[model samples]
Target: MAADDHEFGGQHTDIKLEIVEKYLQRYSAALHTWCDAVWYIDAFAGTGSRTVRVKAKEGDLFEEPAPEYVEQRRGSAKIALDIDPPFDRLVFMDAKPKHIAALKALKASYPGRDIDVVRGDANDLIQKEIKWDGWKKTRAVMFLDPYGMEVEWDTLRLIADTKAIDVWYLFSLSGLYRQAARDMSKIDATKERALTRMLGTDAWKSELYSPIPPAIDLLGSLEREDVRQRAADVAGLERYVRDRLAQIFPKVLDPWPLPPKERPQRFSLFCAISNPSPKAIRLAEDFGRSIMRSR
Candidate 1:
């Protein structure tokens, strides 16, 4: 893939990437003994490795000598491909056509590997079209990394409902909540739908806004108002998403109890583990705590 063709984020994202690589490595090893064929599915897989400009900042997960453009980091697609004992099957889906072409090229690069590339909405494709005949027996690991709050809650439910798959989700809190102004005067229609899809319901309106005003009087702090308190803040919203996932997933693993105060604009990596094993607990609890303590 061309250098400019992929999605770009801050160098801090590599911390999350390294966690993903570590989890994939340990997870596959632990399950390979019992499962016959392990699978890796990336719903929002980028072209491959993208560019990340590294700069020192507070709550930074990665450290570097100086602020420079990073090139050694590979995207999820490449990292998963390099895992030991490797996945039996690899599935990649992205809404962008260019990303599909990029994946197709990767398929050409590795001719013998079993890789399926689909171009469409992952919410529908993963739920309806993707065949899980082998998945039920061997098990699967899915990575859902959407740009904003594009991933639907029901899609998460469907994946967790399998009882075998484990998921790593990047829930973008800053991107979604910033869509609406601080005031409750006006709301964007498209953002309204996106928020509903992300949260699984319109309950966020009542949770985030105070007094829960009617549609006609959605103006100012008089009747319908914005909650200026920390209770309606971004951290609160992130926690709410995790709580929603806990209802379906038996074990919801997150490194932080709340959003990091230093990087409020960044997304938090959440691991929704199903059918938790001993290794899973160590990875989520022990490892997660150590990582947070280091920060």
Candidate 2:
């Protein structure tokens, strides 16, 4: 697919790329010394590039000129290929045919490199197709930048079971908050199922909601209503997710809310270490915290 066919890059997109690149560089360098192999997996890898629309500057004409578009900005796939002390294996998986074609083309550009472009659901590819037996001798870093809540909680548990891969998850905060509607009655069965699958549990209903107080009618009769309100706001939603991740991963850094400090946060960029070793957890958190703080 052409780069323009993919979603355009925005401020949040830029920040996500920057943070991942910083972690990849440090991760690859640190593991290259003793580890036999290190892998980089782009689970929702879009085309190897993104398009950025640059607004045209004011001109002499009454109406402003059309905005200019800039394409071919290096994405996570390309960034991984270019890292020094590079990862031994690179995997890019996407469900769309066009995206798969683009990833294959990207693989061709880096000839002789050990890169695998798989076309399938990210969750399925990780759980069923990818080999976990080799995980003992190898380490990996997987990037999960899903469009919405495509990632299943079971997949996260599988990754954590590997005990050798680190993960950078760009969780959709707005997606969760929106799907789990403010009014409990508004959430249908489909939305409830989706929320349960993503969160891996139905406990969110109780943790995130509160019951409405009973009222009395003018006729002196007490009235009881089956109503509930969402008690978790944006920040609360984010905290719930972080706590969920902590259940599986040994170390999860405090995610950096995207569009940084802005209202109605869209995504939470999280860095989690699956490795249980104290050294590994400490190193990953140190790098993750510093990178996010500097950003």
Candidate 3:
């Protein structure tokens, strides 16, 4: 698929880069403070690099290769997890054979690393593997960016229950809600399952039939405090998720929830979930604030 066709890079800009950079900085720094080794996992890893234009020293700009974290110095963090084998330690797993082949070629380019480019599903991989035995003291950040809603909630629940991994998930409220609301019959089963997992309940089913306006309208109203306080309510929902995570892992910190309006161009929501430690909370909050400030 083309970069522009993807929801993440469709409207690629510097702000998108900034939001990811902030999280990478905090995630990397936190791992460094906690353990001697850390692992970075991108469950929905794309073609390793995206075509984006960044500002240069000159007056003009040019399209170049950019990964999820471009600002940070290379080797500052450990392995990158992606379905594409751009890195040596890349764990490229996908349902498509072509994707696996692409990752294989990419992996061959980089030699001498623990790369596991399996042609399978990440949810199954996580269920069977991604343990906490050897990684007891080590920190791992899992980036879940599905194309639509193929990610299962049970998988996420299991991952969260482990308390050994922090998740940087892209919740496509607008995208998924829009599709499901428009055509209930057309909604993919995988997408529905993923939505259920992310919402932590079946409450969304009520919205399907409810006279709720379009997602754009709802988000617009949410932006205004006078009209039923939609934004506040959405923020509350995020808090609810954060609290639930805290209950599962008391050491897990309150998630720093960034609403879609904050970065309407790049994402609808950007939340950071980590273990409940003072340092972790601070780092998450700092990253969230940086995202808001960047806008």
Top model by lDDT, which number?
Answer: 2
Residues 23-136, model 1: lDDT tens digits = 787777777888788889999998766755455554445853454444546888989989988888899898988888888888788789999999999999987954456446
lDDT of 3 by residue, 1-295 (tens): 3422212344332343445555665666656754765666666665444444333533336755444422321111122532122222335566666556655666676666566667678788877786566655666666776665566666677776665566766555445444444434455777666567666666555543333343436546554232111222344444544554454554443333334345432234445454567766666677677756765
lDDT of 3 at 6: 16
- Clash pairs, model 1 backbone: none
TM-score (C-alpha) between model 1 and the true structure = 0.79
Model 3 RMSD vs true structure = 9.5
On a 0 to 100 scale, what is the lDDT of residue 267 in model 2? 92
Tens digits of per-residue lDDT for model 2, 23-52 = 999899989988979999999998887766
Candidate 2: segments with Cα more than 4 A from true spot: 1-4, 59-67, 222-224
Among these predictions, the greatest TM-score belongs to 2
TM-score of each: 0.79, 0.93, 0.61
Clash numbers, per candidate:
0, 0, 6
